[model samples]
Target: MDVTPLSLARVHFLASLGFFALFLAIALALAWVLLLFKIQARRTGAPGWTAAYRLWVRLFALAFVLALAACVPLLFQLGALWPILMERVGNVLGPLLGFAVVTVFVLKSCFLGVMLFGQRRVSDLAHTLSVGMVAAGLLLATFWLAAMVSWTHAPAGAVLVDGRYVLLDWVEAVFNPAMPWLFASLVLASALTGAFLLVGVSAWQALQRPPADAERMAFRVGLRLAGVALALQVAAATGAAQWIAQAQPAKAAAAAGYWHGGETARWVLFGWPDAAGQRNRAEMALGRLPDWWLGRSAEGGQLGLDAYSGMLPPVAATFWSFRIMVLAGLAMIVLAGLTLLRLHRRRLDPAGLPRAWLHGLSAGTWLGGLALLAGWGYMELGRQPYAVYATVTVTEAAGDIPAGLLAGSLAAHLALYGLLFAAFVRMTYHAARYGVVPVRKAGARP
Candidate 1:
């Protein structure tokens, strides 16, 4: 297989998007967690709650800054790599992206300063509201971005004239069938990402020193919130899958590594897709699981990759990424549930817990983040061969860029992203261990 400029550009775009997305998700989650901490601080007037708020605000600020910085490359890549995408869907995508940008700018310029710096100058209620508004802005911005992506997968309220897509109804297009499920799943995933980070950091802090009130509170809340979010994710993921299956059956079939359509589809436990032979080379699957899961029978219809020969996505990539995502999600659910149960049995005593359990929790901090990245990989790769589903092929949208130029830029992006991630981990670890810095000395007068 030849490595074309288009492939290199896609790799570069994916790398940039992944880096931006992880920080974006973390920032969104941390904003809400900060709000909770602020509310608790004001209500109880406890130093512990205040300490927690101060500690997490630093992480939130770090995430927000990185997310913002990482987004610049993606914005440029849209024009550099797939310039025709805008020409084709600019009527619909331009406004959606503009809305997202406006929300982000307004919140960052207005409320972020208040949330981070105005805690001392503003009233308690005013500061709390700022934090809440920041979270709302993040959420609103996420919805618009998600709406644009979802519309590409299932282009609703739009019609093609000659080649360009023209919008028909705003409500139907923005709130398409796939938008709700994708947005809901993303929010739940973000919550899990933040919750696990909180749990892991709090647990690590306990292991380093005796548990403080702030650590105990953070640990308990993180555990409970993770459990609740995982519970809700079950339905959100299922709904998303069912909708995708209906909207893009070829992508769904590729995820399952199904080559031949049948009423009773196999739920692949493990498999290697052989596109050349049009079958799975070393497949291991539960043949009846799909029937049970989807409520299908012999009379029901199922589509597979065979139905869309030249239009199929990369089978192995989709299949394995989906599997990784599901496996990661299940592992997190089990870990969270088990930890919660043990804590409950021990009467919520961290002192009674084994060090090994804490180590496991610490090591599992990235599981939620891993699941999120893998799920995104599956979603994006599953839409392959086309930039906008069946409407426009990627090759059609790809700009006339030289392969050498794309390769050099891709390398630079990877190097920078690696350094950024390393700095984030190192600084975060240092802060979690040492605690937040005070604005003034303990004996200083206001």
Candidate 2:
């Protein structure tokens, strides 16, 4: 099992991406929670909502800090592991990234501090506006990242000029073919991630000995939030799936396990992708769904591996990531449906929903993260063997990549991120347990 420099670069790059995604999801989730808290306070005027608002403000600040810290390394990885990407198109992407730095790093970070430190200095209305702005910044950041990554998968805005890739149209680069679909999916995913965190934490709070009523309110809010988000996720998932099917058919073929040539391709739950054979070694096939679902009809739009001639990305990674993402999605839909049913039946009252239901949500809290990670892996891995689709192969663009340095960097990152994760979990647990900041000097104008 010899690991080449290419493999080392890939592993380190993937690790960096995974670590960054986790923290980013946390930050986005916390931002959404703040916004939800603001809306809840406006609607109910309840002390419970106020307490929830204060509690979430503390958690969001912690998440924002960790996410920013994790991102710093990823910027380094781009140059260290994928120098080709930076050298070739740095100019084109530099401005796009600048937008996120300003919107998210500067604007979001400033407002976040105002919310955390300026509590007494700012009015309640001003505090709410601050949190809302933070949420907006998160959304903008998500969009910018998604669009940039989507461009790598299916580049649209640049051309190879002389020996370098040059930016021809900023519009085309920013609004790549895969950008809108990916952006839609990620937006729903952020909400889903937030809902799950709320459900997990609030459910734990509700199960405390003697279970406070405010905790019960938070639990109900969590479930309802998840339900509403799940409904929207269905629409988003559909668009994303269709976009993948059409824009990247080779990836879609791998995903659906449709290796054999046919108009009606069978969907596989799991299998070994035999790239050399151009087929799945062992498959559990569910027929025609990918074709019909994508509105491709009987003619499956050349889903077989044989359809493509050039270098194809690894099939197994694409296949399994897609499978895992879809399974996670199904699990979320079930949870959401059950939540909605309870609401409609009037069973979700202040007396507190069943212990079993709370426990169920707590148990499944990681599903949103699983779905998001798997979907990201599917999207990214399916474009592999190339740093940029059709333009740069991993080998061609590596640019004297240092295997030893990458391995060292990967180890250091894992250690640092592990510490960060432990700290975050501990901080959040204490925050949830203690429950909410005190509403200080409510009548003061200053």
Task: Go through the candidates in order and give the C-alpha RMSD of each one to the true structure.
Answer: 2.2, 3.0
Tens-digit lDDT track for model 1 on 76-157?
9998899999999999999999999999999999999999898778778998999999999999988997999889887898
Weakest 10 consecutive residues of candidate 2 by summed lDDT: 291-300
Model 2 regions lying over 4 Å from their true place: 292-301, 347-352, 436-439, 442-446
Q: Which regions of candidate 1 are displaced past 4 Å?
A: 292-300, 345-349, 440-446
lDDT for model 1 comes to: 0.86
TM-scores for the candidates: 0.95, 0.91
Model 2 root-mean-square deviation: 3.0
lDDT computed for candidate 2: 0.74
Query: Residue-wise lDDT of candidate 2 within 231-289, one digit each (tens)?
Result: 88888778777877776667777777666565566666678988777777766777556
The model with the greatest TM-score is 1
Alpha carbon lDDT of each predicted model:
0.86, 0.74
Candidate 1 Cα RMSD after full superposition onto the native fold (Å): 2.2
Residue-level error in angstroms, candidate 2, position 231 = 2.1
